[model samples]
Target chain A: MTPVPDPSEEWRRLDRRTVLVTAAVLTGVAGGAGLPTVLGLAGAMPLWRAVTWVLAGAALLVGGGAAADYVRWRRTRYRVGAERAELRTGLLLVKRRSLARERIRSVDLTAHPLLRVLGLVKVRIGTGENAGGESTLELDPVTKAEGERLRRELLDRVRPDAPDSPHDGALAVLDPGWIRYAPASFVAPLLGGAAAGAVMQVSEWFGAQGEVIEWIGDRFQDTSVLGMIVVLVLLALLAGTVGALGLWVEMWWNYRLEREPGGTLRVRRGLFTARSISIEERRLRGVELVEPLGVRMCRAARVDAVATGLVKDDEDKHADHKTLLPPAPRDLADRVAAQVLRESEAPTGAPLTAHPRAARTRRLRWALGSALAPVAVLAVLGAALTPVLLYAAAGCALVLVPLAVLLALDAYRNLGHGITGDYLVTRSGTVRRTTVALQRGGVIGWTVKQSSFQRRAGVLTLTATTAAGEGAYDIHDAGEGEGLAFAAEAVPDLLAPFLKPTGVRDAGVETRKTRG
Target chain B: MTGENAIRDEVRLRPPRNAVDERAVTWWRTQLLLTTTVPVVVLGVLGALLQPARFWLLLTAGAVAVAGLAATAFFPAWWFRVHRWEVTEDAVYVRTGAFWQEWRIAPMSRIQTVDTVRGPLEQFFRLSTVTVTTASSKGAIRIEGLDHQLAADLAERLTRITQDTPGDAT
Candidate 1:
């Protein structure tokens, strides 16, 4: 079905609801600005006068903003033509932007809580150029239905002769059971810490700091310090769990991944602030299965699309909009990845070849060294300061040593690399394990690095440099001979011309001997 | 013997020779001297005015300035000798660095943009710097100290090559 609107139609303005949103926003700003004055005048001035002043301030701000917004809404106009999508905006400067239909890569729609209530959404049409904001055209407060129609019309450029078309069906949808994994994420502890800090900060602000501390101390009066500490930790954890669950629900309440008509993979999600992201099938390279330490322990993983032109707009948001599936069962993540790639088998699930033993040794030494540095510093400080510091140093070492060893072992276990069919899979890390299944053809070059230590150990780091995804996938500490051979085999003739006949030594004995 | 050993042996040998402009040494020395002189002069004047007792500091500063100027005059010539770039049909090779040498090879097809930049100092010297930007996160590779005409010609040639080759879907 043709999704294009009538070409004869004139440039249309945004939804009328934007005026109300602007008024509401201005009222909020006025209230925030006048709060201090209201509180200061609470005692000296008459109550009605104070109220009148606040009301007048709010009314004036809202009236001015609403009038300006009305003018802006009147001036701003957008037209979706057969060849280009044009947006003419700016009150005085008269900035006009038009993106060619063929160059449009993605059409993303976002609706905040207010916009959602008003049935309006902001649409950002991108050309996938890395030229910052210049490559995108924003249409704020468009009707939800109009936004959807625009998305479909702009992205309906599927190849006619394609053998296997994109499956026009829901690939993945949110499962309520996945919410259990939400609190299990790293964000839980962070939220817990933030909650603890907020409590202290708020108490201090209200001049009730002593009362709160005294109450806390009284509750733990009969208990030992250790017991009280444990209780506080548990309380923080509980608070964190609730915050994480609430955040998860807000972000992924009705998350749905669907293959829309015309080879577009669209994700519609969020509860209060709904988001619709469309990724063209042709730009997709592969999928990444990320399993953080906590998530991996729970056998849950998140899936991200490794596609070109999916540049992250915000550094603060984890996973950004590239997340295909929230933290779920590893098997489910793999299945969703397979669906995204339109392949029978998920490339990430395959057993990858392990790196040499020397690599593990190197990791262990580094981890141990890192863990010991702090301990050594504490010991030195203890020696210089007091005997009490020695106890703290001992306590630190007692906790850190084992944890460091475990992480080192985990990192070693996670290190592996393999090539399966048209994809090369590389897995690494301990705290945040990532298994990337990258397209072999996407790789532009191979970088081989051998530090003085690595060279002595007869190992090198081989990086498959690509423009898409994380820019580069590295197979760390592969035996020198094996890495070169792998590089040569992966790209055939690319590395062969540089390699000498003497370089192709067997991987096992030399790496082992060098470590000894 | 393994193939990797042969490759490593070849890499150890000097790469292809395509030296930068000879005047680059004088240009670099002048730039270095100019940068160093201001800071040295400022420190010396501040010391002389603010703390007359620390006049020994001024002597030390003068000595450092002399040493810096001497190094600046000598180091650029060595740097100029080391800096080299070669553009082949398939790839562009650039070798640079003073203490820790770096050799970068970017495939011709990976190049997205080629630009020629000339600063006021470079304009005075009739020299230009050519930058080849690839899609790689490693950032652009710059080949400085080329004759103005040569830089423009190289930029044009690289642009033409990039256009002719189909860009990788990145």
Candidate 2:
């Protein structure tokens, strides 16, 4: 902002509207929870008395939350100094934390509906170091413009000498057509199952569990049991599809991926609760192409940044903070991934070297072993108990065996590893296939694992350990020679000291050729 | 068997240059003994006091004791033979594990921190464990059962070496 002279040593308090935001959030929480409390209490006391108690509790909850946040607002003070960004807070046990200004990698702005209404956003300044809370300063609620200004100032950097600007600026904006992929994700069935569970849970809370069950039973009374089950599953699926569509809209309505002037890739999205996430280009190690089973069948994939210090907090572990694009067409995902990494073509889309036959055999064995375990147990119980149980076990085998085999084959087909330019790529998994293109320079270490069975199978797992993304990406069940050669090729001399030369290839010859 | 032999011949990870201190075997034995004895002894005493008439309880305790004794007799030496560590001018190489082997290599430039840990049993045997941590979460190389003085010197040397060559250790 205001590029006024000197006077940068000033401290600033959080926006006073933080208290109001807290109060509103608490009211919503109390309202949702209080209705159930009143219903439960009504059974033990007069309805009017229960209502009065609930109202009193809600008032107390809101008042207490607002008062605590007010104290917090009073205690917190932050300053963006020339060399360091420091924060001082805590009422009883005072704590002061600071990050060297140059080390601050990201300045994110998030505003839920309440904060949006109040024109305030929560600002999180991070060093992109995974040292927990010590490396981050969170301002609960600051003016929206102040948040934006802080983000710009903190992330502003001197442009690199040779700016690669071809793929810069508004890399990909939201395509409303992408919404079709929402129902194809695994989230749909999960949401459907969750919806069914919630219905039962809510009805139970209202002490209408029996009535709800009776009502369902009465509706299906004329239908056969199999027909009823099919109809109910269909209804749950319908509910799930609608829920998934709504969730997709809420999360990705205004999705935009932009590359700013200073090499920062920004993802701005969300409808009611807007989030602006920034990832410094220098911190990015690579990109991952994620294809959940259903999405892959639809020829769609999601792109996630493989970068240092993009870890999600424990509370939001399920949130994909690194996602640059929602599920889109495969080629679009690849293009966005390529642009994200500033490469002409995506490394993840490179032709990968398939793993040896042993890897397929391994997957087949595992799939069959897992699928047969339950069948064996059922068969044993059936043999010991009843003929009816035996028939059920047979039916189970008939359904599970082919499905498991298909998945095993699919997983086998997905196994691949390759190198494209500066990135080393690996792909695996059946249900949730992921192709990770990791910058070879970012690989810090290598771990070679050989279980007794794996050794017997003539395969081993090679893990490229890096500080980015998942910390380690595995090339599973690779041929021993192929894996070692790939490792040596990927990082030159990192794995050289530990590898022994084969008889036919002299170590010196190998070195001379490889170095050349 | 011929195919297995051919696969084994394809690529091999040379064992690291140095073996851990000889006392590591005894230290590991003492540690494993303590872990196994405590539970077995507790079970035996509780069973004798509360269910003395239940002969099966005593038999079960006896069986556990035999198994523990056999493991204490052999496992430590087996593990010691497989556990090795070597630090070169470029990187740190380590080979660990007994049944399932792991070979790790982390370049000197990637090391973030160097630490020395001494457990009570390790201290009793005058041994220390030197841990070299890299930015990667999975890249912590542990060189266990070194002479206490040697471990300290190693950690100090690593710290000095990595301090001069680094790009934020990432």
Q: Give the per-prediction TM-score of chain B.
A: 0.87, 0.92
How would the docking of model 1 be graded? acceptable
Q: Give each model's whole-structure lDDT.
A: 0.80, 0.88
DockQ of 1: 0.23
Residue-level lDDT tens digits of model 1 in A58-102: 888899999999998888989888778899988889999998888
- Interface Cα root-mean-square deviation for all models: 6.1, 5.4
CAPRI-style class, candidate 2: medium
Which digits, one per residue and each the tens of the lDDT, describe model 2 over residues A297-377?
999999999899974756544347899999999999999999888889888888888787888999999999988888889
**Reference contacts reproduced by model 2:** 0.63
For model 1, the stretches where C-alpha displacement exceeds 4 angstroms are: A1-9, A28-37, A40-50, A163-168, A201-210, A224-227, A315-319, A446-450, A492-516, B1-45, B49-84, B95-103, B119-128, B137-139, B145-150, B167-169
DockQ list for all candidates: 0.23, 0.51
